[model samples]
Target: MRGEFAHLGDLPEKQVCHECIGEKYLSGQIEVEGIPATCDYCAEIETPCLSIVEIAGRVQTAIEQHYSMTPDGPDDYQSAWLRDKESDYNWEREGEPVQGVVAELLCAADCIAADILELLSDRFDCRRPGDPDEGETEFAHTSFYELKAHSHRDWDRKWQRLEVALKNEVRFFNQEVLDVLKSVFNNLHQMQFRTLDVAVVQVGPSTALEALYRAREFQSSLDLKKALESPVGELGPPPGKYARAGRMNASGISVFYGSEQAHSALSEIRPVVGSNVVVAKFSIIRPLHLLDLRALKTISFKGSLFDPSYAEEKQRIGFLSTLTDRLTVPVMPGEQEREYLTTQAVADYLAGMSEPELDGILFPSVQDGKGVNVVLFHKAALVEPLAKTGRKVVSASIEDIDYEFDVRHPEYEINTETIEELGGSVPMLPLFFDFDAHLESLRQPEHREPSLRLELESIEVHDIKAVVLQTTVLPVRVTPQRQHRAGHTESGEPKF
Candidate 1:
């Protein structure tokens, strides 16, 4: 391989797809196997590096303290991973037992966590790293470690052990460790063994930029002393540390977090876009700090634009004085999204607008930017395909997939999810501060200061009403011209 080495001089500078720009798992290609290829990202996404480094340093200091006095173990979170490595090596590496010592300390720190798991396995194999490659199976690495838990009680016990192990394993303590532990805990605490069958939930890069923008808008010149005055509500740390799951693309949400890692990420083209920015939106759609909303400068909505009340509730229980302009939105549709416009077709038909004009057309009620406006498509507006692909059961899990709705759906459209169906998973939906709905009613074009008396839940509770509309003025009067739309059928299309 040394003889076949190729420096930067040997390869043509391959370009990443335009859409892959500003990603943590960046684009830009290298000659692998002597061929150029365009593929998906190959690196884990980024977050606050300084914060991670700080936490790691803290762990090391804590370990030293415990080692000096007595062999106290690591945090259960940390021990589960590192303890075994300690047990396995237990001796020196590279003429020094530091790696082994680190492992032992990890086990000691998480002794309590190990007690909780109390799992033991009969299969313990001591082999070099090359003996256990992950290419064999999805659960190969997991099963290899878990096989030691033969004496474990149940699935829960094994999972708990897994958590500790992930945390303890020094290698797992990296960014990848954070990602894995978060996933493992979420699954254990929420679905148990269930899969997310409804929504293709993912965080995108755009989410990061939007969040930073919000933080910038909120903090014009407020100092940290002034911002953290309140733990949550009108003043605080800010919710920009979380994931926003709006109808926006997954990349948007991910970029939001990646941007936080460093100012010089290849995925982020904008520098110093915003600092210490806080964001609050309709839902915790992506990921963010989950400690408490009261600690951050955040706000959320209860319903959508179609609720006939979003604009009215802009100021109730929210940090309004810190408000800034909404961020610029890209016009391209999201990945795996299929929806039609509600009124753009009518506008195009009458005005004979071009495709770009049609795509940019706003609804009648919101064209003026007078109030809160969300894009809602009328079934007639979209060009539906003639042949059906597959059945999508939206109504099946309406309440369960609400985070997606808070991100994408028209605010008024009931997402058709239910808490009861979730079994025991905590729903990650936004809280609709009710007073905001009534607050704007006071302005009614006459600054009347409407009575802010109702609970937020009472504002726009659309308790699943089934209705059928019948209109005598049919579409039979219209005739189509030949174009890209000829393949569409005359019949109506069903959209989610």
Candidate 2:
């Protein structure tokens, strides 16, 4: 072993102990069965030690396994001819000095012997300060050393396959695709849990987002009062039969689409000029587990370079970072059905997850960048009844038998003096109707207890006179070409 590396330099006979080595892995090996002797590196009296020559070989093995030499050639070579014309062939060879690499492997500590590093540098054919052809070079040996690129080609291919599959191939009922999604999302969920402070967010009655806005557009000729009096059935998500295909739901599937901001709700409706838009706020009454796609844009992954799973984890992090754009890119008017298939499939997958049981997805609005859009699955889309009172009225009736009806306003002093004069006890008026039963009769058996409540007082009616559009204008250059009629000549020759 010593003869093999004799050409490098004089082999250091000094015995260096494991304590002199800064790297944990290498030091552990030396500590196991190394002979007890004086350590020349650290100048210790007696310790578990190995010859510097043996340590040098171990360092070389680690470097070869984990790192590679960066190419020193000019990156922007114009052509093969230009590369061939160059006299310097330095680019053909790669790698930094083995001395610097050894230092890095041992963590650049003073306890590491300089002699062992010098010996390794001579044995390894590395780019150094002095060479036969070149006297000296500006490049430092450390600059040329780089950790080898992780082998993640399989993941890249899989991601590409998924993109193609979602776009043109099988989108539904593909076990292969589902398996991939299961793996990816499982890992993502685990990562989110590890960083609970910044990942998935919870929204409910207690959160800052207690309510969300939903808007509906109608013809200006519609009665504003009647629209205002519309029940939750009309104001909330439409029934399955009336549900239209949207970004997150297919036709015939009902899902509640709402926004954190009123403007976002109005923007999503895209009401035409001279139309009426009624916006209502719905209070969230139940705990909603939501995956915030916006947070993916800023989330990061940190792992050790030595870890075998680091590459895969890093790749997953990268995919998640771009996931928002992949799902939210604007689709053209006629291409919506085709373009929405991918997002719809994703939505369905997310809704089906039971491990964490997500209620909905919160994403940035394509219609309004500053606005956030929420899409609750069918399970979470039910709206709570407007009436919360416990009173039960049996029947309702008018006093007079006259056909005419009269409406009037009553005034009263509501202070303590007036209340005291009236004995503070007012008799209950006769019940005119069974309000509770009437509401119960109107409820649909197919729907369950509402997770959301309609805020009647928050409803607003807007008459849209004009629509403001923000657009990016690109200059178009038009070129004119003369047209020629195709006809045979007088002699039956081809015409020009």
Candidate 3:
């Protein structure tokens, strides 16, 4: 999931897609070689076990009518059984199966995505009174049931802005918000609404939103609803999702396929793995409502090179900086690059230059497919010192695993309760998820302390948290310059 081909390492440069020459596809696999122009989802030939994920979409109509009218509502429940399979890992985790592979990847699979799209199309058609857009595929997956396929990328961009606002509101009314969230977690099991991995809600104005939780556990969703019935005190309806049935457990690293050109997503992956969140998938694009930075850190990424057709600009050289600490993005290893800068030549060049904050060296690691083999050698010079001093250099070596089981337990549903709770009546803009910030919160718990950090940011959401990444960036310091002020200026400048 890195960017398009640059060609410097063991792997060959990737071939540009026929339809979109700028957007390159993989040319080599660890064992499987020569990838065709087919899309990854469509290309996977082996039939994988299908896992269905149905979450609550937007409920525009009244709850009673909405609930009663929808044919496939709760009462028309289809049993989601966990079958024993010969897959590598047991999805149910109960025990071993003999022949079939347990479903592991939920939404990543094309089959599952296609099936869910079909199911959503039906739900929205009935949920909304006059919405003909219900049958559309992209609409079914959007946070609000109206996003079109061509507009998805734009919708995502708009969503990030909304995410920031929802988080910002946390500073205003947190405890009351936490109470509602806690209620969702406490009664989720009893409500018989067990497996929800993803939930979507609308962002707008709502004077009064009444929802109920009906099950053996809680008497009504309104049981706790009355606690904040008054709009004066209900400062929340925080624009994004609040919590999940078990989101923290499932959160992990996700490097999106397209958004690599502008932003290099080398997100830290400590929070999900460190704190132990069950992952929804390898990458969480538009994951649960909130900006789960902890989960974002576990991922790394690079943007796809644009279609060569769009790359009309000529004579432009792009350079990618350091990747991971262990990575070494070597130059193209052919004799040509070697001749340009011999070891002696490079040494002579360096000797003439002053030691200006030498963090590490850059070297080419591999040349796979048509993609560039750009890698960074973080702390390259420090390795020898630490090794000589008997200190350890920590790194995780990547090894390919044959994934077989499909993740099916927790499913992403269109959560109406969450939407109405978030204040959709009064149209609120979408939000951008700050996953990196969330991961950082895990490190400095003090920053996310509801009372402390929330007070500063006015964030009072229950379980106010973040993942804090503590990396040693060499901050070069110098003595502060003295400001000369008289009747001059407030900044200590001399006023003439």
Residue 302, model 2: lDDT of 57
Model with the higher TM-score, candidate 1 or 2 = 2
Please, what is the TM-score per model? 0.14, 0.65, 0.14
Off by over 4 Å in 2: 1-123, 126-143, 146-160, 192-197, 220-227, 389-449, 478-496
Q: Cα RMSDs of all predictions?
A: 31.8, 9.8, 34.9
lDDT by residue for model 3 over 133-181, one digit each (tens)?
Answer: 4332322332221111121233233333333433455523345433422
Each prediction's number of clashing residue pairs: 67, 4, 98
Candidate 3 lowest-lDDT run of ten = 314-323
Q: Give the per-residue lDDT digits (tens) of candidate 2, residues 438-479.
A: 654454456555789887657676778788889999999986
Which candidate number has the best lDDT? 2
Whole-model Cα lDDT of every candidate shown, in order: 0.25, 0.70, 0.23
- Model 1 lDDT per residue over 101-131, tens place: 3323223223311221211110122245668
Residue pairs clashing in model 2 are 395-432, 395-433, 396-432, 396-433
Which candidate's TM-score is highest?
2
